[model samples]
Every structure is written in structure tokens, then in C-alpha cells.
Target: MSHAIGAPLIWWVSDYTLANESALIVGDDFGSIAKVKLESETGLKDIEIIQQNNQQLSVRLPATISYHSHALRLYQPDLKTFERVWLNAPKIDWLQGDMGVKTSTGQGWLQLSGKNVDTLNLQDAFLINKTGKSYSLSLKESDPWHAVFNLPKQIPVGSYQLKFGQKVTQPTIPPLEVFIVNQPTDFQQRVLNIKDFHQSEDSIDHTIAFKTALADLATHGGGTLYLPAGHYRLSNSLFIPKNTQILGDGNLATHLIWSKIDKQESIALINLEDNTRLQGFSMYHDDAAFGINSPSDRVINNVHIEDIVIRMSAYRGHPTSEMLTKIYDQILKRFSNKLDTIRLQANNITLKNNDIYGTGRSFAFIDSHGINIQNNKFYNGRRGWYSFSGCSEIIFRNNTITGADLMASGGGINTLGNKVSSRNLYFANNTLGMFNGWDREAFTSDGGGASYFGHVQSHKENQLLLATNLRSKGLRLTPYEGAVLFVVDGKGVGQYAKVISMSENLVHLDRKLDVALDNSSKIIICPLQENYIIVNNTISDAAIGIQLYGTGLNHVVYGNTSIRTGGINLLGLWYGGYQSAWYTLVAHNALYGSANTRKFNPTRTDLHTSNITVEARPRSTDELNLVYGIVIRNNQLYQNNGVSIIGSQNARKNMDAIFVDPLDN
Candidate 1:
């Protein structure tokens, strides 16, 4: 008989038998008892198997099992059956512990003592609410005995019970409570009352009192500095210390207006450090008021800015005709002013439920991680979100953006790979409006990671000479020595060659093409990245809904609706790093293109008629293969051009299909 590995041998015992410690219910149909043994430190020790029934049998043990680890083996002599079972008797030293205030995307730790605790698999654990709703727990990081779980962002704010194990009868360990407030429970104990400093709304220079209060708070460890309902003027920037919070009455009640007597070119109204919170206040800046400024080198974490309103351009008095013209040009043409309301370079930050008006750039994150920007409203801003310099795991969700006059730059959300790579970035369920500039997109990335091939001029000696189309003029190509270049169109379209060297418009290959190319051939470099999901978003009155440049891997663009905008545009993948956008799925997007607009005018390209339009223009024997492992299906395109291709095969008239590795299917 073949022995099965890693299979659990089930042995069920009743509560009465468990207490009596005589009979054990094996739940098997064996008629006679043969042999029983228990695994010990030295080896297996034989135990007598007395009095047997179909469901129950008695085992003679040296002592009471108690709460100890045991492994038992059973053998049936008549049928020659053998089985092994591992049992863990668990004991809880403590039943309840505080899990702290659970905010959305917050983390907390709980320590519990129990026998055989190391065998617990936290992956199967969940938190059950009183309303019978269960939220799955994700183990962010863990040690051998302790683990921290992240609270789900969408979980309802309520009390919940943390549960472990897969069995239905498993009991909850402790009760966890989630609060809607962002401040700590003991926040009131550390508040510095502004009234004690004799600062009033009529004071033109509250800088002395405000600075003194902040210094006093920092001297005795950081705490909350409360500002009452008043319009206080500050001539200089207010620097916030670590582990400090600046609280106010409310956005409409508390106001901090910048009244700098001497004209300064740029001014940051508030500067923050690590673990800082700014809430329930309003700020008014004249020319351009910087909201929060945190430098890159600081170890800033858990910086929460919520329930605040920031109004830039407040000192500009009234909008001039030239400003209005510029705004109109930006609204209609996609031009931007490039001013940021908040400049941040930090990690583990959350900006939620705030109102921002009249800014060039609303929020900017540079080389940061664990950033959450949600439930915020932006009005009259040139850009809503700008992330660059290798930011990862950034989420922009459920934000409403309108009246962005960015001129010819920026968009609702822009991710640029200026110095490093941006990975695991997600944008979900956002409402976007008009942008400035003719070439502006609702969501755009420039120099992302991939490059495109212009045309194949000639093929000889296993090398393909190509003309540069959208290749960067000063692009250094030596780093892509071993990268794969595939033909995206023409004869032998799916064929690929290894890149040897690239100089300006010329590309040298390391392999000969299986077939020659023509003027219709286009090629792409393939060095794919990972984990980009864009789902369930709505874009209206924009030039382009979403435009992806360079190379992206394992990405999904699904369930989006575009009105009066170009639905999705996937441009070239060429950045001299030999990266291609592969393993992508573009599905179920409703895109409406206007006929009067230009074909590429950020307008939808009738996927129903044209599907994906591949413009591969290659000339020589080298083929053009730009994309791979792409699935474009179930899309309801308004117009079908009958000329688009899906993967290596021509798309059928309205057929659902799959495109993947042929051998895997």
C-alpha cells in the first residue's frame, strides 16, 4: 500500500469521552483493535488498545493527557490499515486584550499565550462582527509567536471578534473595536489651549504665541496644540514636531491665514515631521500656500491629515481676466501651473476627508510607500495627485476631482518614473473631470519603463537595423544588452530576437528572424514589472481616460466607464531597459468616442469595431511583436472597425476569447 504524505488522519472524540479519558472516538469502521502507539522523544511507545467498537475504542495511557502535545498511531491487523494523527491540546492563558483603536488600514498587535501556539496558521483567521459580517485578516508581518494584522480599509466601523482556526466551533479570542476618529483616546490630556497664550482672532502676529506653544509642547514630549475658532494670522511657517497633532474647532470655525508682510517667493504654511496629525482646520494662502512640507530624509510615518480645508491663491484677491483666460485655457486645453498644495516625501501616510481648492498641484508624493489618499475632494487644482521617484503600494481611491486647469501638463493622477520604478500602484473608483492641454490624459505615465521600435531598416548577420521612432534622444542603451525584442506586426510577427547593442536609431540583434519584415512591422522591448490593478473608475470630459507608456507586467484594467474621452491608450514600451507591457487584461470598459474629434483625441477607439489598433510600421526582415499574453475580451465597444488584433490572432466579431501561454492552456 502506498503511504500518503501530509494527509490529516481524522479522530473525533466526544466531550464525555474527552472528560472521562477512557474511550476515544476514531470515526472509523474497523471491527477489531490491533495496535496503538504514541510518538515519544526517543521513539514510538506501544500503548494497549482495549475494548473496541465501530466508533469508539479505549486506549491505556501512562497518565492523563492533560494539555500536552501528542502524536498517536493506529493499526488494524485484520485489514492491514495504518494511520497517524497529530493532536494539540490548546490552553489560553488570557482571553482578552486591548487591540487599540482600529482605523481604516491601521495596524495593531495582540499577544496571546497558549500551548502549541506555533502551529497556528494565521492565514485562515478572520474577524467576525456582531452583525455576522466577517473580514479576512492579512498578516502584515510576524514573528514565530506574535503577528500583526492589518484592518481592512472597507470594513465597517464597529466592534468585532478576532477568531482563529478553521473549525466552526472555534471560539473568538478577544473583542476588537474600531473607531472613526483619527486621534488617540488620550489626546485631550495633552492639548495646549491657545486661549491661555492670549492669542485672539484680531491679532495680526500670532507667530510668537504659536511658536512658544509648539516649543512648550515639544519640550515635554509632543502633544496636541488646540486652536480655537478664530482667524489667526501667521507671518512665518509653523513647524510641527514629531508625535504631535494640531487640532482646531472645525474647518469652518478655525482659520489660519498667511499674512506675511514681506513678499516671499514660496512659503510652506505648515511643516510636519514623523507621526504628526493635522485636523479640523482651514488654511488660506495668498499667492501659493504650501500646506504640509516634509523632507525626504525624515523617517516620517503615520502622518494623518484629515477633515481640513486648504485654499491657495487666497492672497491673489480676485481672479483677473488673464488668470481666468489661463484657467479657461487649462480647462479646455490641459495646461497646468505646477504648484503643489502639499509636498511630501514620507511613508505610511494617510490624507482623508479633506477639501482643497485653488492649487496648481493638490498632493505630491515622492519616493514614498504605504500612502492612502481617499475620500477627498479637490476643486480648481491643476493636478490631483502626482507620484514619482519610485513610489510603490500607493492607492488613490474614491476621490472627487474637478476644475483642474493644468494647462498642458499633469492630470487627475500622474505617475512618472523619473529616477526609479513605481510598482504595485492601484487606482480604484475615482471620479475625474476635465484637464488642460490637447495631449493631457486623465491618468498618464511618461518614461514608465518600455520603449517602442520605429521601423526595421535592414536585417543582416543576425542583426536587425531599425529606425528610432519614439526612442529617447539621450537614452543610454547599454543596460539592455540581454533584453528581448519581439516583432509586433507584419510577417513573422510573433518572432523575437535578443538585443545586442542599440545606438541612436539603430538596433543590433543577436538572432536572425524566421521571416522577413515589411513596412508594417513594429517591435517592442520586453522587461515586465508586476501588480498594477486599475478597476471600476469613471472618467468624463477628458482627452484620454488612461494612458500607459513603457513596460508594465501583470496589470489589469477592468470595469471602467469613459464618457466623451479616449477610453484607454497603450502607447510604446521603450526606455532602453528592454521592458514590455506583458501579461495584461483590458476588459469590460464602456468607452464612448466622438466621431468629430480626432481619432487619437483622448476619445474612445471603438473597440467594438476596431478593437485594439496596432500601428506597427516595420520595414526589413525583422518582425514586430510588441505585446504578449494580453487578453482583450467582453468589451462592449460602440463602434467595431474590424481591423484590430488580440494577441497574435485577429479578433473575431464579438467573441469571448483567452490569450495566454499556449502550452499552459
Candidate 2:
């Protein structure tokens, strides 16, 4: 031994692939140990040591190896070379697409993939960005575990990060950026005519000739800027980059206006990005603004708002006047007290046939992903609110919400997932309250109607083991894999699965669990919400007409129809997590009630007393809050208070929790 002065501390190694061809190593002192070598990149070679002592060694593997990890050394007994170490080391994971990559023809290669990406090292790969600026990367194809490279035709939009040599990776979820674009060989030069950059109905201002026709159509790379039958005006706010569009001519002949509501300027008088498009405009705006916003943090993918018409031209008065309720109480006292006449955070969005009228609050798709509000109308608003947070594939169809709130807080839709947890929703055929004359009544004080709220992350199921895989977000999430593994409340509540792969706190699932989850179950894995399909919607004077708070699993609520609302509300509450609701169905539907009915006939006043509720409110006592396997059948209640299921174990803990008799008889 050399009495420890320099090298001799390996501290663990192992990973000689080709099915573990032996490597071991370990660490500490180690006195007598001759020769070893390895080095890689086609240099040093001598291998076989096979065994040793004073700590550990093993070795023997060189059958053929050039890169993907090497460096070892060792030698002692007087041949110099003290220790070294290094093995395997190189792991990228995912990056897909390359070799002349065609992000719809902008081109920019990438590939990468995982495990020893052919040992990386194209001068230590690069990419960096967010100000530090790097670039490098070229290697076009190397594969004992993938690698394609190239990226850097122009690279300049935003966010980057990759590095590889000194390692610097973590930070995913729609960021990347990297650009290339060059198209435009005259397809009418991709149409840009804003009257060839001037002269719209000449109210002048035209914001510098519409930002110089959107920078001359972004240097001939993006398209369509049209805007024919105009009235224009705009004092600011425009942006609209990426594959741009912005057409107009019908939304009552294209009238913009927007003078920046007295420069309160909270942004978005347009904004958008990523394959953007804002059709047939008519944006009017007089106070609480927004009109068309997107990119509240990134993930701005394919957006398209068709036939738009966002109103609010400073209280035209009389929609049940009081000077339009003091202009909706001074537009809810501004300074950002929430206002969204379309404020989506894009991800394949498509809001169609829009109308979004008066006062304020109309749409607000936050943390979005695949949303499609179709045939919209949203009338005389103060709260015809259609807010959805942390969204996921949704389709609020045939929309028509008339009046949601003239005063007191109430909207017409909600989807609480705020940070993440909202799944495939398809609220169908929507119609909601007080038609045309618009006076106020689509009510919804969060979960009293049209509420969806979900996202629960284990409130029990004490380490469940229904045949393996149930690890949890102790890592807070990074390996969502496929996400979705419900079992909302009590022993396997309604059972659900699908996640087939995840680590950093395990999750496995693709199958298993027909019913077997202990500690009074209650779970939720991804950004929650499961297959939802509130069908045939038509609610009337709402105060409750469709709520599935804490949703999960197959939700159906079929053929809906409530008239004097307070009808379909299956709430398995949640305050600090433990949210519940599973396998719901609520059938037939025709419930018409609204005379103050009381939980199910406290001697009704006529109808509408919580028409069809399934409340399972548990906050503590070891949490569970269940609503398992719900079914509420055939419905037709007129004077209300029919299918109630509050709390459970066969209802009525002083009236309400389990009645379960939906007329199969």
C-alpha cells in the first residue's frame, strides 16, 4: 500500500452489459494489485483481472468495446498508475425525430433516445440557450442506443437545455423551442393583405399598420393576415407569431376597436402563438379585458378560435338594467380580479362559432390540452363563465349558456384541477338557463352545477398491493408514463388502471385489481379525472344541474334534462385532497325541480330539492369520502329530491347517504 495519499477509492461500479459480462469494482485501500487498463476511445487495452481482495476488483470483459463508457486503470506493485474508475455513464432518455426532421417542413433534426446514446461526445454535444447560449451538436447517426443530432439551422425562439458532457438535463413538459423555417415561394406570398398594410375603416391608429403586417408575414415564413371589411383601431397588444393566421371579414364584418381599456393593459388583446389562428373577428372590449390570450407559460400548440365575437362595449345597458348592474359591479373591481373573455393557455385548442357577450368572464382554459368548446354562445355575461383549470382532452359541445350570474358569484362551468388533474371530458349538447332575454340563472357556485374538480393523491390504501405496482408521487411526478390509476374511495372503489410503466416511485399498472385495495382505499394517480361524458345537457334555472366534484373513472350522467335546476350533483368532496367519486352513471334524466325541495322531500315545496345527489363528504377520521360504483337510474323526478346517497353504508345518518332504489322494479 502507499499509505493513502492519492488514488484508491472507487466506491462502487458494475455495468458491463451484453448481459452483465462482469465488472464489480467496489472501493477503499487495496494494497497489492497489479495491472488493469481499459481507457476507451481506442487507446489503452490490457483487461482481465478476474478476482482480487483487499476491497474488491473482478474486471474481465473487453470482448470488443470502443466507446459508450470505459476508463479504469488501477496498476500498482510499481508500474505506477494508481486508480481512476468511470464505467458506463451516459443516459439521455427521450428526444425523438430527426435526420432531416420536418416539424411540418421547418426542419431541424434531433433523435437522442436513451442509454449510452452512442456515447454522445460530438465535442460534448450542446444546445443550452435561455441566455447562456451554446449550440454545438452535429453527429448524424450513431446507434447502440440511438443518436441522430444536427439541430441548429437558426435556433432562436426560446427555451433549450441538453448539454450531455457535464450533464444538465431535467426540465421537460413542452419547452424545447429550436427553430428553422424558410418556406414561401409565392402561394400568394402566403397572403398578408391588411390592405397591403394600411387603410382599414380608418379610425386610424391601426397599431403601426398592424405591426407592419405582422413583420411582413414574419419574413415570409408564416401566412394569412387578411382582415377585409374592417373597422380596426387597436392601441397595442398583438404578438400572434408562429404559423400565424388572424383572418376576418364576418363576425359582423370584422370590427376590432380595443383602445386598450384605458391602458390597464394586462396583456392579450390578441397574443397567441404556435400554429395560431383567430378567425372572423369582432372583439369589442370596453373595460375588463383579455379577448384572446394564450401562452401563460408555454405549451402553445395548435390553437384556433373561429367566428369570434367577444363583446362588452361599455354596458349597452338593460339586460335587466341597473346600468347593467353598475357595469357588473365595476367589472368586478379590476386589478385582476379575474376576467376572461377567452384566455386559453393553448394545446390543440379549437373554440368554435364563438359569441361571448357582455360584462365579463366567458372562457378560461388554463394549463390546457386538447379542448374544443363547440358552437358557443355564452350570453349577457357577468358570469357565463366557462373556466377550466389544468385541463385535458375536453369537448364542451353545442354550448349556449345564457345568464350565469347577474351579481353574486356563480358561473356556468368549472373544472378544478388547478395544478394538474383533469381528464377526458365531453360535456355534450349544452344549453344552460335563462335564454336570450338574459336576466340571470345559469347558476353554479363551484360544484353546485357543471363543476368537475379532480386530482386526489392517496388518502389511504396503506401501501396497497393488488398484485404489484402502486408507487405514488413521492417524487411529485416526472414519470407520468401513461397516467391514470383510479380507485377513488374504499377498497378498490370502482377500480381503474392504465399506467404501464413508471419509476422514481413506481406505478406499473396496465391491469390487476378487480377489487382489492386495503386501508379503506381512496387513490388517484395522475393529474386526475377519468373518462367523463355528461351527455344531452339542457339545464334551466340552475342552482345545481350537473356536478361531479372529485371525478374519476367512467362518468356518464346520461340523457340529461333538468329544467328548474338543482338536479344532477354527485359530490364526493375534497378540501385538502382525498377527493372521491368513481364509476358514476346517473341514468335517463328529466329531473325538473326548483321550489326549495330539501334533500329528498322534507315535504317538498313542489320540486327541486337536490334532485339527484350522491354526496359522500368525509374530511377526516382517516379519510375516505366515497361515492363508489354509483348508478342512479331511470330518473324523471318532477317535484324533486329523488336519488340521494349522502355519506354511505345505506344512507340516512339522520337522512342522506344511501337510498339506492332507482326503480329497476
Candidates' C-alpha lDDT? 0.56, 0.58
lDDT by residue (tens digit), candidate 1, 552-571: 54456767876666557554
Which 10 consecutive residues of model 2 have the lowest summed lDDT? 97-106
Any runs in candidate 2 off by more than 4 Å, and if so which? 1-188, 192-222, 226-244, 247-282, 285-301, 304-311, 317-340, 343-358, 366-381, 384-386, 389-483, 486-508, 511-616, 619-665
Clashes of each: 46, 7
Q: After superposition, how far is residue 58 of candidate 2 from its true place, in Å?
A: 40
Q: Give the residue spans of candidate 1 off by over 4 A.
A: 1-189, 200-202, 261-266, 296-299, 318-337, 380-385, 406-417, 448-529, 575-579, 593-624, 639-665
Worst 10 residues of 1 by lDDT: 653-662
Give the alpha carbon lDDT tens digit for every residue of 403-450 in model 2.
644432235333443353555565667887652222223433132111
Evaluate residue 411 in candidate 2 and report its C-alpha lDDT on the 0 to 100 scale: 52
The TM-score values for the models, in the order shown, are 0.58, 0.32
